[model samples]
Target: MTPGTRKSALLAGTILSLSMLAGVASAETTVTMWTFLDPNKTSPREVALKQMIADFEAANPDIKVKVEPQDFAQMPTKFFLGHQTGGNPDIVWIDAKNLSGLDTSGAGANLDELLINQWPQEDKDDYYAKASFDAAMFGGVHTALPLFNGGSMIYYRKDLLKEAGIDPASLTTWDAILEAAKKLTKDNDNDGRVDVWGFGMPLAPLKTESSPVYISLLEQPAALYTGECEIKLSSDLGVKGITYTADLITKHKVTPQDALVINVDDVTDQFIAGRYAISIGSMLRYSVIKGKAAFGADNFDIIKWPSWTGEKPGATPLSGWWVAAWKNSPHLPEAGKFLNYMLGKEGVGLWTTVGGQVPTRKSVLESPDFAGPQYDWVRLMVDAWGQTGYMDPPSCNTRTLQGALNEATARVVLDNLDPVEALKEAEAKFADAQ
Candidate 1:
């Protein structure tokens, strides 16, 4: 054969190989995920999540993740309904309150069968939030992997505490914090209106399902719900939690009256604007709050929830978001790979450093990355999750429960109803939901 003929044959072979490679790439599986966060956005958490997905794609050339951002409050209802109608995405983000119907409806697949979820006992034990994982399980099968496991705690100004000579340790109980708030509330310019209030927390469920402050207090936590899934908000602890939240507005005046209509995000903004010396905020707000703290991010740190009875630390609701697979997705395995990658060591590690989340991994939280004063709040939260935290029992009707509890707070704070009577009304409303 001629040398020119041999060259043409080699070129043909290379062209065929390129075509086959492109075909293989085109056949890659796409795993669709429904979450509240838009990875395309510029927020820190969103940017981190986007980076995580990019890294996962780089690692696994055969799988692709398509993130569908939804309103977080709408995820549960939309997902459950989608499951019923065969229109759900391959994966979904399940918040704590909506975990009840997951297993029963088979909307969430048994994640235990996933290879990544079958971690070694040591790897499993390394996860700090065990209850979070347990909360995702139903009927002896794991339904989801707990991705962002965190709870509410007090974010306070270190500078304010030091200036007022208020020892941080002494503010261990709710009552003590109230006293400190009163001392901190002052008008530096001698005006009738106070400039810097002592505390700020959002009690209105006007925007969302319920108030996180009220949840941490009333659910104060597992004790609030009885055997029949009936919430006993009228209990002593419940009444106490209720009265404490209301009195802060009406009696103590540490928190502004306008707080009655705002949500946690609104109050976080107020605290960042330097309106409050201390505020009740979710652990998820750590990075955002840290960035905007007028007193300096390092000067701002979270403390453990002040104990109600002072016997133990207050309840940290086993709250936060979860990543679960759809039972009917044709791409279930690929979905698990994406979910596991996002929740694994590298991904979960980024949650602390990049996303500002209190991840479920202990080693990630305890690492050198999380060391020092800025991350001390992370330690306090870890302690609470490991020791005193509790999640509410699974209930199909959490929206109603939250709505009822919100009315209870609104009536007490706005209408001046007795705390006991307010809570009794809350229980009655919760019962009506059943």
Candidate 2:
């Protein structure tokens, strides 16, 4: 070949090779995710999350996951504002209650097509119960996938129950629980004040931290909202439930009087200090209670929330964390791929193993790892799941509705106002917010 022709051919080959390298680089997509998971924390949840991201990137060499951990308290405001300005992340982990707020505003992507067209039927069937998945839908569109869930449980000192000659299982009804509490309350040192209360519950009018006891007592579905989608805080059942909760402090004198003003952390601190025989709150407290409570892990166990007569145990509603992709995410395909990866069996197992979360899939829940003596409480929680339900509140007014619920609870339980009157006032406030 002529020297000029050889040089031209070599130049064309180099140009083609460079063009191929550029195409390969452009094929790799970066999917940005925002979360409250702190990578710095060595907790199971945090470590597992970091590992999940690393594993996903390794498996999908063409996709990169950038997880930006944000301050937990500021996430809602940040996400909402980001959505408004088109600066939101491709994916986010949201609290279940908060999802409605983002979803109804059109910030969440409709995952129906993906669920139906992309996901295998076997994979879809792996969810613990269809309820968790069903709850993720809003307006018939799949808004998110269940990440983990927690419910209110009554953690008790097994030693205390034994000393009181009370079988924890027998306290399956509110009346029975109060009776047990009466027997369990004592002034051990003969001090004027009761040092050990039978039960501890948070009742402060801040956030919805104090709403669990009341919410636990109300009947399903109807307990959340009226048929018209208005707050049903003033309903007959609502009044009855809150009244019973107040009576536990005012009349029965079973729970600490200070419970009227305490929050979850305060009550939890006291619980770990061995100040109460029974405490009502989140299952997430299991880690601290088991790892740090003065009574030791062996002495601590949880009973399902008691139910009204004719109802099964754990009849209350359940709530938890969820994951979703943004509606306007630039990398929709990649976002969906990552979501499925994070929620798959290996991902769920890691979450349950490392984070101490209750598995949201039936197969995982029934797995031997989730059973046996070490997982006794998890087993009971599954039993409770059989009886509990989930009802999503209107997202637009979640903060307001939560505030209203707290205020009404304070008025009824702390101020000694009539339950019906307090709830009616809250219903009015809810209407105004709407």
lDDT of 1 by residue, 1-434 (tens): 79999999999999999999989877889999999889988767888999999999999988888999999878888999998899999999888878876876779898888743588887788776777877878888888778887666777888888899998888878888999999888788997998998988766654442343354455345566675766677777667777777888889898888877777778888888899998877778788877778878777877776676667776666688888888999998898788778888899887777888886888787778878766766787888776777666665466566556767877988888988898888778777776
Best by TM-score: 1
TM-score of 2: 0.85
Question: Where in model 1 is the C-alpha error above 4 Å?
Answer: 1-21, 207-223
Global local distance difference test of model 1: 0.79
Q: How far is candidate 2 from the true structure (C-alpha RMSD, Å)?
A: 4.3
lDDT of 2 by residue, 270-351 (tens): 9889888888867866765666778786898888877667367746446677788888899998998888888878888888
By lDDT, the best candidate is 1
Which stretch of 10 consecutive residues in model 2 shows the poorest summed lDDT? 207-216
